[model samples]
Target: MDSNRLVAGITVLARGSQTLGTAPIPNPADRQHPGDGLEGLPQAVPGAVGLCLSGGGSRALSCAMGQLRALRWLGKLDELFVISSVSGGSWANSLFTYLPEHISDDDFLGQPVLDPSQLSLLIGPHRLDHLPPHNLGEVPTRLGLWRDLDAILTLKERHGYANDELWQGLIGEQVFKPYGLWQPDASGHDPRYFTWTRRYLQGQNGILAHNPGLKPGSFLCVERARPFAIFNTALFSNDGPDADLIPFECNFQLGVRHNFPAQPSQQGAIGGGLLDAFAMGGRYLGEANGGGWVSSGRPARPFALNDIAGCSSAAFAQMLEEQYPVLSGLVPRYPYWPVAERAEQDTLHYRFADGGSLENLGLNALLARGLRRLIVCVNTDQAISRDPASGDIVLSDDLPPLFGLQPFQPGLGYLPYSAQQPGQGAARLYRHNQVFARQAFAQLQAGLFAARQAGGAILFRQRLPVLANDWFDVPAQDSVELLWVYNDFVSSWWKALPFDVRAALELESGGNFPRYNTFTQLELSATLVNALAHLSCWCLASDSTLGNQGGLSNAQMLTSMFD
Candidate 1:
C-alpha cells in the first residue's frame, strides 16, 4: 500500500476538508483507495452511525421528517456520520438542506417538514393560475362525467411533480446555485448546477464562514459525515452481468461507488463504471462517469443536483411506461437537461430509472463505508395505483431481499418482512411491482444456495454479499455487526387525510383530468412514535426517558419485525 502517499493525501484533506476533488487515488499498484478515509472527521470514524431512508413518494418523506424530529428531540442528530436517501426520501432530504434563504432557519426548523398549510397553499387559487399553456402544472379542469376523476388527477399531478421546477418550488429559487440562495438576482444569468455540498459539512468554521448568529450545519435536526444521494441508470446490454443493483453514490461530486457489487472470492479488485475494476474502497473525484480522481481517458462531466433529482425520481420511468410504450417514450425535458453530459447530439439519449429498481431502499453502496448503525426508514405504500371501487391506495412495490446484509445476524431475510409473501390488495395498479421484487430476490437466493451446495459459495458481483466484508459491515456481537432498525410501512399520512378527501383524490376525471394521491403529517408522526419506541433497544434510554413514551418496553421490541 502507498502508506506515505496515503498519509500525505489525508494530511492535506485534514487541512482543507474542501480539497476532495484534489486528492489523488492512493496506490493504484496496491489498489488501496479511500472509502471512510475521510478519517479525522467525526463521522468518518468506523463504527459510527448510518441513517438510511427509502423512497415512497410524499408519504415516505413525511415519515422521515417525523423520525428526524424524534432524533432532534433526543439531541442525537449529530451522532450520525452519514445519511443516505432515494426517491421520495430524497425529496424530503432536499427540503431539509436546500430551503430558501428567504425562509428563516426558525421558520424551517420550528415547523415539521410537511406543513398542512403547504398543502393548503398549493391548493389555493393562485396555484392553477400559475400553470402556463405550455407548462401545465396542476391546473384542475373538469370533464362532464370525469369531473371527479379530473380533480383527482389534477391533484395527483399537483402534488406528484418531478421536474426542474421542483428544485425551485421545494427550496424556492436560487438555493442550489453557487452564487448563493440569498443572491437570487446577484448574477445576470443563474447557473443551474451546484457542487457546494462539501462546503456545508465544515460547520460554522473556515471555508463556509456564516453569520455568527446563524447556526452551523451541525445544529440541524439531522447531521452526518456527508450527505449522499444515490441515482440509478441502466448500463448497455454488454456492460456487466444483468442485475438489479447498479450501485452509485454522490454528494456534489461523486464519492465511492460501483456499477456492480464486490466479489468476495476476488480480493484484489472492486467494481465500478461499465464492468471496470476499481479499488475495494475507491472514490471517483473526477468528472468520470464512475471511477475516482485517477487514470486517463475522457472523463464524464459532473451533473448538477437537478440531474441527480431526475435520476432519483422513480416516477420518471414509471410515468413513461404508463404514458407511452418504453420503446418510443421520451422523458419530457430530460433530453434537454441543462447539466447532462453532451452526447452524439446536443441531447442525452439514454434513460435513467429509479434507484428502487436496484434496491427499494438506497444505501446498497453505503454499506461498504464502515456503517455501524443503519436506521432504515421505508414508506411501503406509495400512491402506485388506484382502487376503482373504494378509491383506496395500493403500495405493492416491495424491494428485493437484501444481499449479505448482516449475514451472521439470523433473520428470515436481510431486510424486514422480505421473506414472506405479501397479503392481498384489491383492484390496484403496480401490484405487480412487489411480485417482481420478490421473484428477483427468490431467484438470487436460489442461485446462492445452489452455489453453496456445489463447491465454494459464488458471491455474485452484481448482488449484495452473502457474507459481510471488512469494507462494509462493522464488528458487533463478536462479528461484523450492523444494528438494523427496520420499519416498512404504508405511512399513516395518507390514511390520516379525511375519508372524503381521499375519495376525492381517487375520483376519476372523465376527459383529460388527472388523479391525485396525497398524505398528511399526522400519519408520519403516529408511525414514527412506534418506530422510535422500537429504537429503545439500541442502548438508548428506557421508555420512561422517551419524551413521548409508549406502553411497550425495550424488551418487547427485541424481536425482528421481519420474523
Candidate 2:
C-alpha cells in the first residue's frame, strides 16, 4: 500500500467534508467558482454513505434492502454512500430513484453510472499494466491499480478541502501494504481445494477478530509482521482525532443464468457450444457438478450416465457375487438378464429357491434398505391363461409367493350363517384374498406413519389386481393410468397429513406394460440414475409449498413415472 497517496486522498476528503457545511463561504471572485449565488455555499452540507453489495447479485437484493432499511433506522441517512458497478443497471436504477445526490464521479469506481444529482462520479478504468503477467495471457486484463488511484485522486480534487484538520492528521501518518492476492499451499489442488482454502482463511480471520483476550490481527501478525504492524497503526490511530470511514470494501452481488445460442453446432457433441462457455466462466466450476462444457454458447457436453454404464453393471455383478454367493449363482449369465426376462415372459412367478426368486428378493431388499421408509401393499390371486390349441382359458393355482413376505390369508367377509353367505368354496376363498389385500394395505398406511415417527423418509407402493377395485385398473395393458391413479391418491394422502407426519410416498405396480418396455432395462436404469442424481431432499408440493413432505421423493419414482 502507498501510505502517502492514501493519506493525501484522506486529507482532501476530510477537509472537503468540513468545508462543505461549516466553513465561511469564499466569494466567487476569490476562487474559480462562477459568479452565481450558489458559489462558496456548501450545497446543503452534502451527506455521504458507502454501500457494499456482494454475493449473488439479483438474488441478494432483498438482503441489501434490509441492510438499507437498518441503516436508515440508525439515522445514518446523512452520510449514505453507494458504490456499485456500471453493469449494476438494475440496482443503480433502484438506488437513484430513492437516494439524494451528494457527490459524483470518483476514480476508484469500477462501474460508473450517471446520477440525477450531477455530483462527481468516480469511474475506475480497467487497466492491468502494473502487475506482472504470468499465466493470465489468455484472460482479458481490466483496469490496473494506477488507473484506480487516478480515479480516487480525481474524486478528492472535486470534494476535499486542503486545510481541514482531518486532512492533515490522515496525511501525516504511515500506511501499511496489504497483499494483493492470496496463494494456496503446494498440497492444495483445484476443484474443492480453492473453496476449502477460502473457508480456512475466513475462519482464521474470524477467530482473530472475535478473540477478546488477544488484540485484533494478533494471529495475522504471527504470520506476516509487516502487514500486521501497518494494520495495527490504522486500528489504534489517534492522530486524526476521529475515526475515518474505510472506503475500499469491495462487495457486490452477481447473478448469472445459462444462455444458449439458437444456432445448433454441427459437432457430434451431446450438447452444444454453450457448454464450453459455462466451463470457462460458470460460477460452479472444478467441483463434483462442474463437468458441463460450453460450445457454441450452449452446454455442449453434459455428464451422461451412459458414460459409466459398463463399469456400473460390472461393479454391481461383482458386488452381488461377493456379498451373497448363493444368490449370485442363480443370476443369469448375461447382465440384466433377469429384468429383461421379467419384461418378456409376463410370468411373475419364480421357483421358491431359484435365481429368479432370489432376484426379486434382492430387489425388494435394495428398495427397503436404500429407501428410508417404505410401505408395500400387494394383492395376489390366480390368473387364467388360455391354451391356444384347446382355445380354452384355464384357471391355474400358480401365483408366486411375494419375496421378503410372510404367509398371510384374508379372513371371512361375513358370518358363515348369514343368509347371503354361500357354502365355503373357491369363490369364497378368492373374496377373502381380495379383502385381505385391502386390509393389509390399510395396515401398511399405519406403518408409514410409524416410520415417519422414527425419523425415516416415507414411501408406499400399491400392487393390486384390476378386478379387486375400480381404483386400480388400466384401460390398456401398457398404459400407466393405474400407476398414476395410485400416485395421485398417495399424493392426496400426503397433502392432508402434517408436514412432519408424511415425507414421501411411492406407488409401484407389479403388472407388466408391454409398450413401455420398448427400452432395455440397462438403458432405462442409466437414464434413471442420471435424473436421480439431481434430486434433493427439499420437496415442493401443490401451490408451491416447500417442505419435506408430499410428492415422489425417490429418484427411481420420478424416472419410473416420467420416463
Candidate 3:
C-alpha cells in the first residue's frame, strides 16, 4: 500500500502539523522508512538533542531530578530537546516536566528528605508537601491471594479488583497527580488513558468524543521541545531461557495529520499505534491491511493505556519463567492466563518489563532523535582501578564499545576511516567497532574469560549489542564523541539495598518488579547530587558547550579520550 493510505497514528510526525504551527524540516527520507521500512534506524530532526535516563528504581529518578536542577543551574535547562526513560526514571521525568511555576531549583539541589532507615522515600524537605501512595496493597490476604490471582487470570476482564485498578488509581492518581504529572477522567472507561499529555504544541484530543475533553497520550508532538520517554518490554519470547526485549517509545503529544494516509501492519488488521479517535468513531474498517481500524465485521475495542506500559514491561512473564520459590505458589494462570498465541485464543498477556532489562540504558533510541553529541549518565562506579598484584591502573567496563578498546591492537594505534582515500582522511572518523580491531577484541575477550573464571565483576557478559555510531553524527559530521561519567556511589548504595530493591535497581537488565522497589527521596537526592556534580565537572571541562560541538569541532576532546 502507498504510505498515505495507512494507519492513523502510524504516519510519521517528522512532517509539520497545525499544533506545531510550523512547516516540517524536510528530509531526504525518514529513517523509519529507509528503503521500505527496514533499513537504517530512525532519523532525528536536525540539531535535536535528547537526554536518556537510566533505570535504577526511584533513587535513579530522584537522582535525575538533581541532575535537572544542575542543568538549570548551568543555564542549560531548556536547551534539552528530548528526555527518555524507563520504569522509575519515567516517574521522575514525568513529574519533572509536568510540575508548574514556583518549583525552585534548590528544591532539587537540597538534601533529599528521608526517614531514619533510608528504606522508604519521603515527600517533605523539598517542594513535595506529602507522599503519594507509590504503591497499593490492601495486603494479599490468606483468604484472597489465590482467588484474586484466579480472577486476575480470567479476561478476567480488565482493571478489576485484581490488578489494573489498584495501580492506575493508587499509583498514577495517588502518587503522580499531586506531583502534577497525570490528570484523570471520570467518564472514560480507562482513567489511566484519560490524561492530556501537555506538549507545548496545540495537540488534538483523540478521545474527546467518548469522554469529552479527555485524550489519549500523544504518541508524538512538535509544539514544544520535550524529551521522549522509553520503556522496555519483552515483545517476543524464546519459549525457554531468553526473551526478545525491546524499548517502547512514549510521547503524550497526539498528532493527527489531515489528508494523511496510514500504513498496513504485516500481521494484524488492527495494526499498532491506533488512536482513540478512530476506535471511538465506531468506524468499521475494511480490512487488516487497509489500516488500524478494527474489522467492520468485529467491533474495534479501545486499546488500553496500560497496554502501553504492559507491553513495555514484561514483569509478569519473568515471574512465571523464573518461578522464584517464595512467590511460585501465588503464580496463577487462570484469570490472567497466558493463552496460546493463536487467534482463536481468548486473550494474551502483553509481557512488559523495564527497558534496562534489554539494554542497561535506552541510549540506543536516544541516538535516533538527532543528537550530534550523546551523553549517558551511568550507575557504574569508578572508571579506574588498581591491579592488586602489579599496582598498575586498569579501567572498568563503565562505558563499553569505548572502554573495550585497549593498548596494542591489530589495526594499529590510529583509527582511520578514510585510510583508503588520501585527503578524505580529514572527512573520516573513528569506527566504533573497528576501534577495538580483531586483535584488541580477542585480547579483551581473553581477559573477560579469565575474569569469569576468577569470579570478578561479571561472571559472564552477554555479547554486546552493536552501537549505532554511524547514526548519531549526521551526514556532514566527522565523528561521534562520547563523554563517559561514572558514579561510584551508586554501586555502594545499590549493593547495600535489600535483595528485592537490588533486583529493581538492576543497573544492567534483570527481571521485572511485581511491585517496584523502595527508595528514600533523600537517597535519590544525594545520589543525584553526586551524579550532577560529576556532570557539572564534565560540562565545565568541555566549556559547557558540549551540546553545541560535535565531529571535528570536538576533535580535541575525542583525540584525548581515544588516545
Candidate 4:
C-alpha cells in the first residue's frame, strides 16, 4: 500500500480546505460555483435539469428503465445535469452510466432500428403477441445468473466475507453482466483481480470509451456524456433524528464533485466531503502526523463497481438479522475537521443500506442543489386494496406514498402529482393537483417563512435539507418546477391500447396492470415487465399539473429545464 502517495493527495485537499477558511460543503446558495474536485467539469446551474429516480426494488428498476427510454427518445438524456437515484432505481442508474457505449445508445430496449423519436411508435398501439423486448443484457438463463453466484461463493470460501459481498457479486453478474465486469477468480488468479476499479469501469479507455473529449491519460475526469450521477445510499446511524424513520446520513457514490452539509440551516457545515471515487474503501488515518486523511493501508483494494451497487441497493440491510446479514458495509467517510474531527480521529466504519431507508424520492439531494427544474420518478406503492363490493383487486387512485409525506412536508412544500393513473378521472386528478399546488404556495406566501418557522425545515440531520427559510435569491416556491411521475397505468396510454391488447394484459396481470408487488415479486414475466416500463414512460411523457399548465405536456415541462 502506497501510504505516502495516499497521504500526499489527502494532504493537498486538507491544506486547500484550510486555506478556504472552512471545511468544504458545496454552498447551496452559490449555484454557479464549481466544487473543489470538480473545478474543470460542467456544474449544474439554477434552472438546470435534474432527474430523480426513487427506490422500490425491481419495480423501480424496470420503471426507471422505461423513463430512461422516454428521455432518450426525447434526446434529453444528454441534456440532464444530474441524475440522483436510490435503491432499485440506482441499479438502473448504474447500468445507464456504465453500459457499453453501443448498448447504452438504444436505451436498453434492445431495438435501435426502430426510431424512438416518434411518440406514436414509441408507445403506440402494439399487438399483445408482440411486445417490445425490454432486455438490459441480463443473464439469459437462470443457470447463468447462478454461475456468478457459484463463483462468488468460491471467492467467499477462499476469503472470508459477508452477505453484502455476495449480493454485490450477484448484481455484477445479473444486473451488470455481459459488460466484461464479471471477472471472478478464474484459474487461481488473485481474488483482488476479481474486483473492478473506478478507473477500469469509467476511465478514458474504459467502457465509457465512447465518450468523446475524455482527458488524455486521466482516470478521474468527469464523464459528461452521461448525466452526473449520485447513487444515494442509507447511512445506518441510530444517533440521527428519528432513527426508526432511518434519518439517512446523506452519503453518495458521486460521479461528479459535490459536498453534503451536515445541517439544513448551515450551508457549509463540513459535515461531509467527497471521498475520491477511487479511494472509497481505503482506511482513514486521523491520528497520523498531520491530521485526518485517507491512507492506503495493508491490502489496499479500491472499491469495486459491484460494491457501490450492492451498498445502494442493500434494502435487506435494514433487517439486522438474516440468514446472511446484509446491513454490514464499509465505505470511507470524510471527517469534519476541528469540530467533529476528534470523534472520527480513529478509523471509521460506517454501515450504509438502501437510500430508501430514509428518503425514497431522491428529491432532497436535487432540492439541496437548488435546481429549479426537477423531474422525480417515484415507484413505491401502498398495499393494494380489494374492493368491498366486488371483492376484486381495486385498481384505481393509489396516491403516491411519498415517504408518508402525501399532503406536504414543511420546508420542501408540496409538488402536485403530475401524472394520472388508470382509475383517476382527469378532472378529479387536476383538482387534487390544484389543491396541493395552492397549499404549497400558501406555505411559501411569507418571505421569511423559513426564518420564522424553525421546525418547518426538512430536518434530516445527516444531510442537507430543503430549509423553509428562503435559501435562494429567487422565491423558493415560485422558482421551482417539479414533475412527479409515479408508477401507474396512465389512463390515456391504457385507452390507446387496442381492446384485445388490454384484455390480454388484464388477464396476464390478473387485473393489476402496473402496480405489481415490489420486494415480494422479484422475478416478473416479460410481459408484465414491459407493461410496467410502458406505463412509466407514458406517465412521464403525458402528465400535466398546475405549474405545468396551458395544456403544455409534461415532456415539454421537463425539456424546458434544459432550455
After superposition, candidate 1 runs with Cα above 4 Å error: 1-44, 100-106, 109-192, 196-245, 259-302, 324-350, 382-400, 403-563
Off by over 4 Å in 2: 1-441, 445-521, 524-528, 536-563
Which lDDT value does model 1 have at 40?
21
> Candidate 4 at 171: error in angstroms?
1.6
lDDT of each: 0.32, 0.19, 0.32, 0.45
TM-score winner, 3 or 4: 4
Residue by residue across 23-110, what tens digits does model 3's lDDT show?
Answer: 2322322212111221111234654445555555443454455455445544444555456665445555555554443443344233
Winner by lDDT: 4
| Per-residue lDDT of candidate 1, residues 1-563 (tens digit) | 22111101111112112223333222112222222232122223434555666665544554455455545444444344456777656654655554444544333323222211122212443221122221101111211113322422343366543332232222222122321322222222122323233333242331223222222332211122223333332211121232222233444433223212224332112222211111112222223222222212211211344445445653533443465442133231222111111111132223345555545566443444434345555444432333455442222343333431211112232332323532222111112122112333444444333332332211111222223322212111222223232232112233333444334333421110111122112112222222222221121212221111133322222111111
Query: Distance (Å) between predicted and true CA of 402, model 4?
Result: 7.5
Tens-digit lDDT track of model 4 for 9-106: 13122211211111332322333322332212233464577888887766777778678877877777766777888877877777666555444445
After TM-score superposition, the amount by which residue 511's alpha carbon in candidate 1 deviates from its true location, in angstroms, is: 26
Clashing pairs in 4: 450-468, 450-469
| TM-score of each candidate structure, all chains considered together | 0.46, 0.15, 0.49, 0.63
Q: Model 4: residues >4 Å from true position, as ranges?
A: 1-42, 107-134, 137-160, 186-224, 238-271, 286-300, 317-344, 383-478, 542-548
